[model samples]
Target: MSLTRKRKKELKRLRSGAEDLWTQQQEVLANANALAAEARKQAAYYTREEIAPRVRGGYDQYVRPAADTAKATAGRYVGQARERVVTDVIPAVGTAVGTALSVVDHARAARSAAFAGEFKKAGKELTKKTKAATQNSGPGAGSVIAIGLGIIAAVGLLYAVWQTFRADDELWVADEEPAAPASGTTQQ
Candidate 1:
């Protein structure tokens, strides 16, 4: 019904340990987020610098010559129009697509960073407010524990007093008739 001093001390130590573990978890989460952002940037850069050029080279080698042949088979005015689309429009579209992907990646990174900053700021503000409120509030943990202990002790004492003073006449049960006495024994 009551905690020993050692038990209470152990509980306090456990609470502090849990708080330390929580702090470590928060640090790990922040570090992981940073690493993810860096990885994203690296991937985007690799895509733009390495992969995009290779894709463009493939398109030029395989697709452009075919378009040129098709344009030659067509008449002069149609060929000129096809040449414009092949030379100008397709490359522009590819470049635009690459630029859009880059912009989207950058935007997502910026949004993530902004959200992280705001979340940290909110956490700091909340901690400050909680500390201030606790400083002004009544009945800290020790007081609460003491009150709980007092209630438990009161209940225990009341139970003991009740048991000590209460009658127990109805608690016993005897056989309806006594077993037959041994042959040499006399009945009272």
Candidate 2:
């Protein structure tokens, strides 16, 4: 196409405007890059000077002491458990096993002794010892039943209190019927 004089002049003006815009955009981009570099430097300096020290101080002041306390508590509990196992549980288990084995051996000896006609005297002593062992001075059947009933009553009382005081929206009885949905809506 052949351009007219006015169209050529307009095209030249447009070209200069485009170049000016391009130069402005390059300057803006350079400024933006410089600002971003300065921001990064400031962030690094702030982190090194303020944030790192604050974080370190917090760790030393709060975290370190709390961790040490927890560690000590855990260690104490573990030591107590170890001591209990060594002193109480192990001895109790050993004593129980020893007693059982001794009882079995004694029964066997008594049976053999009985065959030799020496059991009549030994049997009376055994019966007395057995009776003494079996007669525990603990709670009787009536006491056990009373305690169980008391516990049940206490649990029932707690349940009643909880039910009375609890904030359960679902359990609330509404005083009025709910409002109907809008006429434009339909239930599925």
- In terms of TM-score, the best-performing candidate is 2
Per-residue lDDT for 105-154 in model 1, tens only?
A: 55565556557787665555556545644664575444454566679999
Q: Where is the poorest 10-residue window by lDDT in model 1?
A: 136-145
lDDT of each: 0.76, 0.80
Could you tell me how far off, in angstroms, the CA of residue 68 lies in candidate 2 after the best superposition?
1.3
RMSD of each: 42.4, 11.1
Q: Evaluated with lDDT, which candidate comes out highest?
A: 2
Model 1 quality (TM-score): 0.36
Question: Residue 28 of model 2: what lDDT?
Answer: 100
Per-residue CA lDDT of candidate 2, range 1-188, in tens? 99999999999999999999999999999999999999999999999999999999999999999999999999999999999888876665565555546567666766776778897856864675466446646644444545666799999999999999999999878799889877986779
Root-mean-square deviation of Cα positions for candidate 1 versus the true structure, in angstroms: 42.4
Model 1 misplaced stretches (Cα beyond 4 Å): 67-188
